[model samples]
Target: MKKTPHASPAAAAFVLAAALLGAAAPAVARDNPVDPVSNPDKLDYRDVEARRPDFKEPFLRDGVVSRPERFREIKPGITQAQVLAVLGQALKQQRGALGTEWDYHFKFQMPQSANYLVCQYKVVFDDSQAVRSAVWRRRQCLDLLPR
Candidate 1:
């Protein structure tokens, strides 16, 4: 029987080492990386990026959903009507020795957490129906609450 040609073990190992070295070599950026011939219509990438709008405004908030930013406008002595305009409506209300307290609950979401947080904004109004105090607090979801 005719013997088939086969590379020696040493030759095979050398070939493998050469291939690994070539792959491990760091890639060098070409001076003229863009191919004008391949791309018939050459476009300046930098110019396109420069024309794009860079938004710097805040996208996340820490207030109620209806109008979170309005919370900042709340202050003592503000009429109940004004608070209502800002927070929409209280989820629960009750009259106490201190004053009439209103409860505002909202589902607060944070970028880092996978669960939704429960936030409560309690606004206390004096007998005159003017806000006397406002308090805000946040708690994790019921499922996440520690026993």
Candidate 2:
């Protein structure tokens, strides 16, 4: 009688899994610029600075703390994700049966070392996840709304 080596069930399963994964690996590696698992060093960082609001823009510095004009881009039909892309992130969020709301706080620059003005920007979103409205208000800063 001749004896022959046979793969166990587990060993056969491992080999089949490896073969399938290996076949798909090349296709994934070809198009992706940065591979978190195999080639993380190639990850791009060029957009990191661009995504930040520029300090040179005075409106951004005084109005919303950063990128106040971005608020103007918001419209009734834009989604939550689109709003995030424009506004970076909200300082606080509130959700209710009517819709969701995001708030960002801003501080005013005043003279004579008096207490600075504080303001809040509110953005509301409907159940459909679309922007319903955006507003900024402060009782003290009524004279200098965007200052």
lDDT of 2 by residue, 1-147 (tens): 999999999999999999999987854233323433322233221111323557455443233544333556877889989988887688778774346878666665564566555555567788788987665543343344343
Over 53-143, each residue of candidate 1 has an lDDT whose tens digit, in order, gives 5444332223354434556678889999998888888877887556788876666454467645555556788889998877654222222
> What local distance difference test score does each model get?
0.60, 0.59
**Native-to-model Cα distance after best TM-score fit, residue 135 in candidate 1, in Å:** 0.8
In candidate 2, which residue ranges exceed 4 Å CA deviation? Answer: 1-64, 107-117, 139-147
Question: Could you give me the TM-score of model 2 versus the true structure?
Answer: 0.43
RMSD of 2: 19.1
Backbone clashes in model 2: 0
Model 2, C-alpha of 25: deviation from truth (Å): 77
Task: Tell me the TM-score of each prediction against the true structure.
Answer: 0.46, 0.43
